[model samples]
Target: MLLHFISDLIRNPELQRQFSRDPEDTMRRAGLSEPQREALHKGQLEPVMKHLRAELASLELFAVVWVKAVVQVGSTQPGIAAPGSTLALQVLGDFFTTGAFAVVKLEGADLPAVTRSVENPGQRGSVLSCTLDVPANTPMGVYDVVVVNPDGHYGVLPKAFRVE
Candidate 1:
């Protein structure tokens, strides 16, 4: 929840403005805990970094640049796909506004990455949906979903899905 709140702040300018005007009310409305609010109020990143299990430096960078993207699968769609199949993916994140594009990659250890372009992206609110063609020769393993945003910021969601 803390990470999500941070992502919201990074992606939404209105929220940032609101935070600057009234931080306590903004944090309270965001449902942040007392410790989280206090830490943020004091301009401390240590507690946030600890909650994310990330180093301070990297967290700082992420807070400035990256928006968290979550790939939706399993409930309404298959999370696992065979090679050569098309995976219908819905990536939930901010900053995917007008004229934005993303380069989505399926990356696995010791395997060549499978890259797909999300051109003419279909967006509903913060969700961007696209059909990604999994290459026939792709290896069988869990793959991380790496999205490179139009503004050059990128984020990796590890173990997002699997190729059978």
Candidate 2:
């Protein structure tokens, strides 16, 4: 049940918004167990993830970098990108602040990672917007999106986007 809820939360932007607005209520509605609820409420993902790992030994896992942060790729056309394209990113989280730096990278395909830095980022409310330039010579493949904040905290979204 927890696993199902998490899957839904990742795929459904509406559910993500709902969770962001009122996490406790959304978790309750999702019928999460008391312990699961407590763990999530405290932002302690390791215990919950450990339980999930034990439960799904054979299944591939999907994870988010920060429970509170949602990264959206592309402003006009979401998630689709090409080599040499300028990708627009919007990060929604309470942790983002004005003037902080963020490092965005695409890592996968057994290739050297493509990275860009968002220096002196701008934040409005809980949203931070930045752009990353995908190098023209970058290899075409699916890549995991990793974002590192100024405090050295990072989040990873596995297989986040594809380069064609």
Candidate 3:
């Protein structure tokens, strides 16, 4: 619907900021684009709202952005573990594209895998987020929270806190 509008605008190209948050691309995708998201940090809602408006006007299938950040353990600093946090995945897209969700894995002794089914945070959708729980005896080593999409476009998110 609205996406059809953005498709009409894709001809301009500058509007298409990024596809953003492809679970399958996580393996090949590199580090986070911006570790400290100034937008959220500063609580600047303009850019987000601006994009949302553009997406709505575009009239795409779904006006939302989906994000899945598979945070790595032990990256924030030494002796710091995210015991309690509302882990969020940042997504950005217009009417042309909707967010993606697929498989999520917490690799460890048992290879616990889960299919993260989240709502797209597009202009008309809700943002994706999760809470991480560090295992009591979580080895105190490097662990990975890998996120993948069905189409195979993902990014190995930045490492999380360390257990110390």
The TM-score leader among the candidates is: 1
For all predictions, the C-alpha RMSD in Å is: 11.8, 14.8, 16.8
**What's the distance in Å from true for residue 100, model 3?**
6.1
Model 3 weakest 10-residue run by lDDT: 70-79
Clashes of 2: 1
**Candidate 2 on 1-164: residue-level lDDT in tens?**
67878889988999999999999999999999788888777778798897677646634333333332433322212455688787665544334433433333455333222223233232323444557567788788766655545544545556665778
Q: Residue 11 of model 2: what lDDT?
A: 86
The models' CA-based lDDT, in order, is 0.57, 0.58, 0.33
Write the residue-wise lDDT of candidate 3 on 1-164 in tens digits: 22232343355453333323432232123221232132222446775455445555653323123232221121111224443322333222211112343122335432222223334422223223333444455555444433344335443433332333
Which segments of candidate 3 are over 4 A away from where they belong?
1-127
TM-scores for every candidate against the unseen true structure: 0.40, 0.38, 0.28
Candidate ranking (TM-score, best to worst): 1, 2, 3
Per-residue CA lDDT of model 1 for 17-136, tens digit only, reads: 999999999999998888778877778677666656542347554744333332222121345778887766665554444333333345433322233333333232344455666778
Where does model 1 exceed 4 Å of error? Answer: 1-78, 99-125
